[model samples]
Target: MKAAWLITIAPFAACEPVPTAERFIPDYRGVETMLLADDLVQFNVSMTNALSARDVENYAECAAAGYTLIRGWGFARHLRTNVDEEAGVWTADAVYTISPALPRGISTIDAEVVSAACAEKGIPTV
Candidate 1:
Protein backbone atom coordinates (compact mmCIF):
# COMPACT_ATOMS: atom_id res chain seq x y z
CA MET A 1 0.00 0.00 0.00
CA LYS A 2 1.10 3.66 -0.53
CA ALA A 3 0.86 4.34 3.19
CA ALA A 4 3.12 1.38 4.02
CA TRP A 5 5.79 2.46 1.51
CA LEU A 6 5.59 6.04 2.80
CA ILE A 7 6.20 4.88 6.36
CA THR A 8 9.15 2.72 5.25
CA ILE A 9 10.77 5.63 3.34
CA ALA A 10 10.32 7.97 6.27
CA PRO A 11 12.91 6.10 8.34
CA PHE A 12 15.40 6.07 5.42
CA ALA A 13 15.04 9.85 4.96
CA ALA A 14 16.93 10.54 8.18
CA CYS A 15 20.00 8.74 6.78
CA GLU A 16 20.19 11.01 3.75
CA PRO A 17 22.75 13.81 3.71
CA VAL A 18 21.21 17.23 4.01
CA PRO A 19 22.12 19.69 1.28
CA THR A 20 23.94 22.86 2.36
CA ALA A 21 23.12 26.08 0.60
CA GLU A 22 25.86 27.51 -1.62
CA ARG A 23 26.32 31.23 -1.04
CA PHE A 24 28.72 33.95 -2.11
CA ILE A 25 29.11 35.01 1.51
CA PRO A 26 27.51 34.31 4.83
CA ASP A 27 25.14 36.75 6.46
CA TYR A 28 26.83 39.24 8.85
CA ARG A 29 30.31 38.15 7.75
CA GLY A 30 33.13 40.70 8.12
CA VAL A 31 36.36 41.70 9.78
CA GLU A 32 38.00 41.59 13.20
CA THR A 33 40.48 44.14 14.60
CA MET A 34 43.45 43.93 16.94
CA LEU A 35 45.70 46.71 18.25
CA LEU A 36 49.34 45.70 18.58
CA ALA A 37 50.46 49.20 19.64
CA ASP A 38 49.20 52.74 19.85
CA ASP A 39 49.99 53.27 16.20
CA LEU A 40 49.98 49.74 14.87
CA VAL A 41 46.81 47.74 14.32
CA GLN A 42 45.80 44.51 12.58
CA PHE A 43 42.69 43.56 10.65
CA ASN A 44 41.58 40.09 9.62
CA VAL A 45 38.59 39.59 7.37
CA SER A 46 37.06 36.38 6.09
CA MET A 47 34.11 35.66 3.83
CA THR A 48 32.60 32.57 2.28
CA ASN A 49 32.49 32.17 -1.52
CA ALA A 50 33.89 35.58 -2.52
CA LEU A 51 34.58 35.70 -6.25
CA SER A 52 37.39 38.24 -6.37
CA ALA A 53 40.56 39.06 -4.44
CA ARG A 54 39.71 42.75 -4.51
CA ASP A 55 36.67 42.22 -2.30
CA VAL A 56 38.78 40.55 0.36
CA GLU A 57 41.40 43.28 0.25
CA ASN A 58 38.76 45.97 0.46
CA TYR A 59 37.32 44.35 3.55
CA ALA A 60 40.66 44.70 5.30
CA GLU A 61 41.02 48.31 4.18
CA CYS A 62 37.59 49.15 5.50
CA ALA A 63 38.49 47.60 8.81
CA ALA A 64 41.71 49.58 8.96
CA ALA A 65 39.97 52.87 8.24
CA GLY A 66 37.27 52.34 10.84
CA TYR A 67 39.79 51.17 13.39
CA THR A 68 41.93 54.25 12.86
CA LEU A 69 38.97 56.59 13.29
CA ILE A 70 37.76 54.84 16.44
CA ARG A 71 41.25 55.20 17.89
CA GLY A 72 40.92 58.97 17.38
CA TRP A 73 43.39 59.06 14.53
CA GLY A 74 42.65 60.82 11.23
CA PHE A 75 45.11 58.98 9.00
CA ALA A 76 46.26 55.43 8.40
CA ARG A 77 49.30 54.12 6.58
CA HIS A 78 48.94 50.67 5.10
CA LEU A 79 51.70 48.35 6.22
CA ARG A 80 50.87 45.06 4.53
CA THR A 81 48.15 42.61 3.65
CA ASN A 82 48.34 38.84 3.30
CA VAL A 83 45.52 37.32 1.30
CA ASP A 84 44.62 33.68 0.93
CA GLU A 85 41.83 31.57 -0.46
CA GLU A 86 40.94 28.07 0.67
CA ALA A 87 37.92 26.03 -0.31
CA GLY A 88 35.28 28.76 -0.58
CA VAL A 89 36.52 31.17 2.09
CA TRP A 90 38.71 34.15 1.37
CA THR A 91 40.76 35.84 4.05
CA ALA A 92 42.84 38.99 4.22
CA ASP A 93 45.12 39.85 7.08
CA ALA A 94 46.43 43.40 7.09
CA VAL A 95 48.27 45.84 9.33
CA TYR A 96 48.28 49.63 9.38
CA THR A 97 49.79 52.56 11.22
CA ILE A 98 47.37 55.10 12.58
CA SER A 99 48.36 58.76 12.77
CA PRO A 100 47.15 62.35 12.55
CA ALA A 101 48.77 62.90 9.14
CA LEU A 102 50.16 60.91 6.24
CA PRO A 103 53.17 58.81 7.24
CA ARG A 104 55.41 60.17 4.51
CA GLY A 105 54.54 57.42 2.06
CA ILE A 106 52.22 56.65 -0.83
CA SER A 107 50.09 54.36 1.36
CA THR A 108 48.11 56.78 3.44
CA ILE A 109 44.32 56.90 3.85
CA ASP A 110 41.88 59.35 5.42
CA ALA A 111 40.19 57.41 8.20
CA GLU A 112 37.00 59.45 8.56
CA VAL A 113 36.22 59.66 4.88
CA VAL A 114 37.13 56.07 4.07
CA SER A 115 35.15 54.76 7.01
CA ALA A 116 32.06 56.65 5.92
CA ALA A 117 32.39 55.24 2.43
CA CYS A 118 32.88 51.75 3.82
CA ALA A 119 29.79 52.13 5.96
CA GLU A 120 27.81 53.24 2.96
CA LYS A 121 28.98 50.10 1.18
CA GLY A 122 27.77 47.90 4.09
CA ILE A 123 31.16 46.73 5.20
CA PRO A 124 31.57 46.02 8.91
CA THR A 125 34.13 47.86 11.06
CA VAL A 126 35.24 48.37 14.61
Candidate 2:
Protein backbone atom coordinates (compact mmCIF):
# COMPACT_ATOMS: atom_id res chain seq x y z
CA MET A 1 0.00 0.00 0.00
CA LYS A 2 2.88 2.36 0.75
CA ALA A 3 4.54 1.54 -2.59
CA ALA A 4 1.34 2.25 -4.48
CA TRP A 5 0.98 5.63 -2.76
CA LEU A 6 4.63 6.50 -3.49
CA ILE A 7 4.22 5.66 -7.20
CA THR A 8 1.14 7.88 -7.51
CA ILE A 9 2.83 10.87 -5.77
CA ALA A 10 5.96 10.48 -7.93
CA PRO A 11 3.95 10.76 -11.18
CA PHE A 12 2.09 13.83 -9.91
CA ALA A 13 5.32 15.56 -8.92
CA ALA A 14 6.88 14.93 -12.34
CA CYS A 15 4.05 16.68 -14.19
CA GLU A 16 4.67 20.29 -15.21
CA PRO A 17 2.25 23.10 -14.34
CA VAL A 18 0.29 24.88 -17.06
CA PRO A 19 1.42 28.35 -18.07
CA THR A 20 -0.90 31.32 -17.75
CA ALA A 21 -1.66 33.60 -20.68
CA GLU A 22 -0.36 37.15 -20.61
CA ARG A 23 -2.81 40.07 -20.46
CA PHE A 24 -3.38 42.04 -23.64
CA ILE A 25 -2.84 45.80 -23.61
CA PRO A 26 -3.48 47.98 -26.67
CA ASP A 27 -1.46 51.02 -27.77
CA TYR A 28 -3.55 53.85 -29.16
CA ARG A 29 -1.88 55.73 -31.99
CA GLY A 30 -3.78 58.78 -33.22
CA VAL A 31 -7.06 60.25 -34.48
CA GLU A 32 -7.99 62.47 -37.43
CA THR A 33 -11.34 64.23 -37.77
CA MET A 34 -12.85 65.44 -41.01
CA LEU A 35 -16.08 67.26 -41.73
CA LEU A 36 -17.60 65.78 -44.83
CA ALA A 37 -20.74 67.94 -44.81
CA ASP A 38 -22.60 70.36 -42.54
CA ASP A 39 -23.94 67.62 -40.30
CA LEU A 40 -21.79 64.74 -41.54
CA VAL A 41 -18.48 63.97 -39.80
CA GLN A 42 -15.75 61.45 -40.28
CA PHE A 43 -13.22 59.98 -37.87
CA ASN A 44 -10.04 58.18 -38.78
CA VAL A 45 -8.29 56.38 -35.95
CA SER A 46 -5.28 54.10 -35.76
CA MET A 47 -3.86 51.88 -33.06
CA THR A 48 -1.53 48.95 -32.41
CA ASN A 49 -1.96 45.76 -30.44
CA ALA A 50 -5.71 46.03 -30.84
CA LEU A 51 -7.67 43.00 -29.68
CA SER A 52 -10.21 43.39 -32.48
CA ALA A 53 -11.95 45.82 -34.86
CA ARG A 54 -14.35 46.77 -32.08
CA ASP A 55 -11.53 48.52 -30.23
CA VAL A 56 -10.85 50.87 -33.12
CA GLU A 57 -14.57 51.35 -33.71
CA ASN A 58 -15.04 52.43 -30.11
CA TYR A 59 -12.20 54.87 -30.49
CA ALA A 60 -13.93 56.44 -33.48
CA GLU A 61 -17.21 56.59 -31.59
CA CYS A 62 -15.51 58.38 -28.73
CA ALA A 63 -14.07 60.90 -31.14
CA ALA A 64 -17.46 61.51 -32.70
CA ALA A 65 -18.99 62.06 -29.28
CA GLY A 66 -16.33 64.58 -28.34
CA TYR A 67 -16.68 66.37 -31.65
CA THR A 68 -20.43 66.59 -31.29
CA LEU A 69 -20.05 68.20 -27.88
CA ILE A 70 -17.55 70.67 -29.25
CA ARG A 71 -19.94 71.57 -32.05
CA GLY A 72 -22.67 72.28 -29.47
CA TRP A 73 -24.71 69.27 -30.34
CA GLY A 74 -26.47 66.91 -27.99
CA PHE A 75 -26.66 63.74 -30.02
CA ALA A 76 -25.05 61.83 -32.87
CA ARG A 77 -26.06 58.95 -35.07
CA HIS A 78 -23.68 56.35 -36.39
CA LEU A 79 -23.82 55.88 -40.14
CA ARG A 80 -21.03 53.39 -40.80
CA THR A 81 -17.60 52.19 -39.76
CA ASN A 82 -14.97 50.41 -41.84
CA VAL A 83 -12.03 48.73 -40.07
CA ASP A 84 -8.76 47.60 -41.56
CA GLU A 85 -5.54 46.12 -40.21
CA GLU A 86 -2.20 46.56 -41.90
CA ALA A 87 1.29 45.67 -40.63
CA GLY A 88 0.09 45.52 -37.03
CA VAL A 89 -1.64 48.90 -37.27
CA TRP A 90 -5.41 48.93 -37.05
CA THR A 91 -7.28 51.73 -38.79
CA ALA A 92 -10.93 52.64 -38.73
CA ASP A 93 -12.98 54.92 -40.94
CA ALA A 94 -16.19 55.96 -39.23
CA VAL A 95 -18.98 58.36 -40.17
CA TYR A 96 -21.63 60.04 -38.02
CA THR A 97 -24.29 62.72 -38.10
CA ILE A 98 -24.70 65.35 -35.41
CA SER A 99 -27.95 66.96 -34.32
CA PRO A 100 -29.34 68.98 -31.44
CA ALA A 101 -32.00 66.39 -30.72
CA LEU A 102 -31.96 62.60 -30.69
CA PRO A 103 -31.44 61.39 -34.23
CA ARG A 104 -33.93 59.15 -35.94
CA GLY A 105 -32.05 55.90 -35.58
CA ILE A 106 -31.24 53.11 -33.19
CA SER A 107 -27.52 53.82 -33.37
CA THR A 108 -27.85 57.26 -31.84
CA ILE A 109 -25.48 58.29 -29.06
CA ASP A 110 -25.71 60.93 -26.38
CA ALA A 111 -22.63 63.07 -26.84
CA GLU A 112 -22.25 64.10 -23.19
CA VAL A 113 -22.63 60.61 -21.78
CA VAL A 114 -20.36 58.94 -24.31
CA SER A 115 -17.70 61.61 -23.90
CA ALA A 116 -17.65 61.12 -20.14
CA ALA A 117 -17.42 57.38 -20.46
CA CYS A 118 -14.56 57.72 -22.94
CA ALA A 119 -12.67 60.00 -20.58
CA GLU A 120 -13.13 57.56 -17.72
CA LYS A 121 -11.79 54.73 -19.86
CA GLY A 122 -8.66 56.72 -20.78
CA ILE A 123 -9.57 56.84 -24.45
CA PRO A 124 -8.73 60.00 -26.37
CA THR A 125 -11.53 62.00 -28.01
CA VAL A 126 -11.53 64.88 -30.45
Candidate 3:
Protein backbone atom coordinates (compact mmCIF):
# COMPACT_ATOMS: atom_id res chain seq x y z
CA MET A 1 0.00 0.00 0.00
CA LYS A 2 2.82 2.43 0.92
CA ALA A 3 4.68 1.69 -2.32
CA ALA A 4 1.58 2.41 -4.39
CA TRP A 5 0.89 5.62 -2.42
CA LEU A 6 4.44 6.90 -3.06
CA ILE A 7 4.15 6.26 -6.76
CA THR A 8 0.83 8.16 -6.88
CA ILE A 9 2.35 11.13 -5.03
CA ALA A 10 5.32 11.19 -7.37
CA PRO A 11 3.04 11.81 -10.34
CA PHE A 12 1.62 14.94 -8.64
CA ALA A 13 4.97 16.48 -7.75
CA ALA A 14 6.02 19.74 -9.38
CA CYS A 15 9.05 19.32 -11.60
CA GLU A 16 11.28 21.80 -13.39
CA PRO A 17 10.99 21.94 -17.12
CA VAL A 18 13.73 20.08 -18.99
CA PRO A 19 16.00 22.16 -21.17
CA THR A 20 15.26 22.12 -24.88
CA ALA A 21 17.16 22.94 -28.04
CA GLU A 22 15.90 26.55 -27.93
CA ARG A 23 17.61 27.12 -24.59
CA PHE A 24 20.99 26.38 -26.17
CA ILE A 25 20.76 29.67 -28.03
CA PRO A 26 20.13 32.32 -25.46
CA ASP A 27 18.04 35.35 -26.38
CA TYR A 28 21.18 37.26 -27.25
CA ARG A 29 21.45 40.13 -29.63
CA GLY A 30 24.80 40.48 -31.41
CA VAL A 31 27.99 41.96 -30.05
CA GLU A 32 28.40 45.63 -29.15
CA THR A 33 31.75 47.41 -29.34
CA MET A 34 32.99 50.75 -28.06
CA LEU A 35 36.16 52.58 -28.98
CA LEU A 36 37.69 53.58 -25.69
CA ALA A 37 40.87 54.85 -27.38
CA ASP A 38 42.83 54.56 -30.61
CA ASP A 39 44.13 51.07 -29.83
CA LEU A 40 41.94 50.00 -26.94
CA VAL A 41 38.36 48.91 -27.41
CA GLN A 42 35.64 47.37 -25.29
CA PHE A 43 33.17 44.68 -26.27
CA ASN A 44 29.96 43.66 -24.57
CA VAL A 45 27.52 40.84 -25.22
CA SER A 46 24.53 39.83 -23.15
CA MET A 47 21.76 37.27 -23.15
CA THR A 48 18.35 37.24 -21.50
CA ASN A 49 18.23 33.50 -20.86
CA ALA A 50 20.77 31.42 -19.01
CA LEU A 51 24.06 30.95 -20.90
CA SER A 52 27.51 29.54 -20.24
CA ALA A 53 30.76 31.49 -19.98
CA ARG A 54 31.93 29.84 -23.21
CA ASP A 55 29.00 31.35 -25.13
CA VAL A 56 29.75 34.84 -23.90
CA GLU A 57 33.44 34.43 -24.62
CA ASN A 58 32.70 33.31 -28.15
CA TYR A 59 30.55 36.37 -28.66
CA ALA A 60 33.33 38.60 -27.38
CA GLU A 61 35.97 37.12 -29.66
CA CYS A 62 33.70 37.45 -32.67
CA ALA A 63 33.07 41.07 -31.80
CA ALA A 64 36.71 41.93 -31.24
CA ALA A 65 37.82 40.43 -34.54
CA GLY A 66 35.14 42.14 -36.56
CA TYR A 67 35.56 45.42 -34.79
CA THR A 68 39.26 45.38 -35.45
CA LEU A 69 38.69 45.01 -39.16
CA ILE A 70 35.89 47.57 -39.14
CA ARG A 71 38.37 50.01 -37.68
CA GLY A 72 40.79 49.23 -40.55
CA TRP A 73 43.09 47.03 -38.56
CA GLY A 74 44.56 43.59 -39.22
CA PHE A 75 45.02 42.10 -35.75
CA ALA A 76 43.55 42.13 -32.30
CA ARG A 77 44.95 41.02 -28.97
CA HIS A 78 42.87 40.12 -25.96
CA LEU A 79 43.24 42.34 -22.94
CA ARG A 80 40.64 41.21 -20.45
CA THR A 81 37.15 39.77 -20.08
CA ASN A 82 34.64 40.23 -17.28
CA VAL A 83 31.62 37.99 -16.86
CA ASP A 84 28.56 38.69 -14.77
CA GLU A 85 25.00 37.55 -14.25
CA GLU A 86 22.17 39.75 -13.04
CA ALA A 87 18.50 38.81 -12.62
CA GLY A 88 18.92 36.12 -15.29
CA VAL A 89 20.86 38.20 -17.78
CA TRP A 90 24.38 37.03 -18.49
CA THR A 91 26.92 39.58 -19.72
CA ALA A 92 30.53 39.53 -20.84
CA ASP A 93 32.60 42.69 -20.95
CA ALA A 94 35.78 42.19 -22.98
CA VAL A 95 38.58 44.53 -23.97
CA TYR A 96 41.09 44.22 -26.79
CA THR A 97 43.92 46.01 -28.50
CA ILE A 98 43.86 46.37 -32.25
CA SER A 99 46.80 47.03 -34.56
CA PRO A 100 47.74 47.17 -38.23
CA ALA A 101 50.33 44.41 -37.77
CA LEU A 102 50.29 41.48 -35.41
CA PRO A 103 50.54 42.76 -31.90
CA ARG A 104 53.28 41.53 -29.62
CA GLY A 105 51.05 39.16 -27.67
CA ILE A 106 50.25 35.49 -27.41
CA SER A 107 46.50 36.04 -27.54
CA THR A 108 45.88 37.51 -30.94
CA ILE A 109 43.90 36.75 -34.09
CA ASP A 110 44.11 37.67 -37.74
CA ALA A 111 41.31 40.18 -37.85
CA GLU A 112 40.63 39.85 -41.57
CA VAL A 113 40.14 36.09 -41.39
CA VAL A 114 38.14 36.11 -38.19
CA SER A 115 36.01 39.07 -39.19
CA ALA A 116 35.17 37.46 -42.49
CA ALA A 117 34.02 34.35 -40.67
CA CYS A 118 32.01 36.44 -38.28
CA ALA A 119 30.34 38.30 -41.12
CA GLU A 120 29.42 35.05 -42.80
CA LYS A 121 27.88 33.93 -39.53
CA GLY A 122 25.89 37.19 -39.34
CA ILE A 123 27.45 38.35 -36.11
CA PRO A 124 27.42 42.11 -35.55
CA THR A 125 30.30 44.45 -34.86
CA VAL A 126 30.96 48.08 -34.02
- Candidate whose TM-score is highest: 2
Winning model by lDDT: 2
User: In model 3, how large is the Cα lDDT of residue 25?
Assistant: 52
Question: 70, model 3: CA deviation in Å?
Answer: 0.9
A best-first ranking of the candidates according to their lDDT comes to 2, 1, 3
The lDDT per prediction is 0.83, 0.91, 0.80
Error of 2 at 98 (Å): 0.6
For residues 1-126, what per-residue lDDT tens digits would candidate 2 score against the true structure? 999999989988879776334225667788898999999999999987778899899999999999999999999999999999999899999999999999998999999999999999888888
Q: After superposition, how far is residue 46 of candidate 3 from its true place, in Å?
A: 1.1
RMSD of each: 7.9, 6.6, 3.2
Greater-TM-score candidate between 1 and 3: 3
Local error of candidate 2 at residue 49 (angstroms): 1.4
Tens digit of lDDT per residue, candidate 3, span 1-126?
999999888866747577788776556666777889999999988876545777667678888887787778899999999988888778899999999999998999898787777677655555
Cα displacement (Å) at residue 15, model 3: 2.8
> Each model's TM-score, in the order given?
0.74, 0.80, 0.77
What lDDT tens digits, residue by residue, belong to model 1 across residues 1-126? 999999999999999887567554443367788889989888889976666878888888888888887777799999899999888778989999999877878989998888899888887777
